[model samples]
Target: MNKEALIALGLTLEQADKVIEGYGTTIPKSRFDEVNTSKKQLETDLASRDKQLEELKKVDAAGLQTKITELQQENAEAKTNYENDLKASQLSSAIKLALVGKVHDSDIATSLIDTALIELDTEGKVTKGLDEQLKTLQESKPFLFVPEKKEQKFKGWDPAGSNLDKDLPQDIGFNFAKEANSKGAPAEKALNPWGQ
Candidate 1:
């Protein structure tokens, strides 16, 4: 309280001054010190923010916008290039899968196919002339493709125990002369292979 306000409460001039001097001493000094410290910190932060704002005002707005636009364009171009590369990679994988077990040389077959005519769908499938181009390449260059294997047939004689007993007579005699003749030998030579 001020000295005049304390005097208005019926204290004398000396008593009012003493009361004013002892008024705030009852409360801790550290509390006011803390509040003053916080106030100073707030002022310092406000001044720092004001200085930063002044620095920001000095920046070139038009130049910053142009740079931002250029960066955005570069980012868009990079994204487009990445998408194109991804589509091309997917198309190459599709082509390789389609050529598996069909082409003699996969690299040569891939080179022969018209990749420009091919397009990848959203599902990453060949959506255009890839199949037709591969077919045309196969027809134009037959040597590049592995020939379709012909189904093989077994033509050799059957096993001895299989159906032979039913076909032949039970008393079919063993004729040495016929056997030897069939083997391109005389009967005597066939019987004595040692030439004894």
Candidate 2:
């Protein structure tokens, strides 16, 4: 199980190494890789911003001031874009987690969800209309969800609940000591494998 193969499957270096160490066990697609890639891109953007700042320092005072304003605006736009992307990613992940075990077709179910109305709480839980929307969808489009399983109630005797003293006849069970004494054998011989 090569790390490269695992990495190609959208795993990080650490994740790929762990998989290799674990003998190449199957792993589902990871959101961590997406987040990690985004983080690296953000770092690269910051590095470029730093380089631009250094270049701006070498320019005339008027040009440097204009450049500073432009860079600030660009930074603001980048921040907004990053925030929006992060929120969208969070919303998608939250929806997927919520839909698990409930939906038959996750892609269809997720598409049915009105993502615009969904928001995440501070604790990362889906809040402010997601649950209500899911409930509404579950009612209107029942086919998208897995069928609710009905539990069968057993009418037979439950061994775990039954008491042997009450259920079994007193004479039906054997007593080794009584049987051996009746046969004229000693109690010691009946009870112990090695008689003293």
Query: Who wins the lDDT comparison?
Result: 2
TM-scores, one per candidate: 0.64, 0.49
Q: Model 1, 52: alpha-carbon shift in Å?
A: 0.5
Candidate number achieving the greatest TM-score relative to the actual structure: 1
Clashing pairs in 2: none
lDDT per residue for candidate 1 within 1-196, as digits (tens), equals: 4777777989999998788777743445788799999999999999999999999999999999999999999999999999989877888888887778988888788877778888777776777787787777777888888889999988878664354556652222234333555586565546432223
* TM-score, structure 1 vs. true: 0.64
* lDDT value, candidate 1, whole model: 0.77
- Estimate every model's Cα lDDT from 0 to 1: 0.77, 0.78
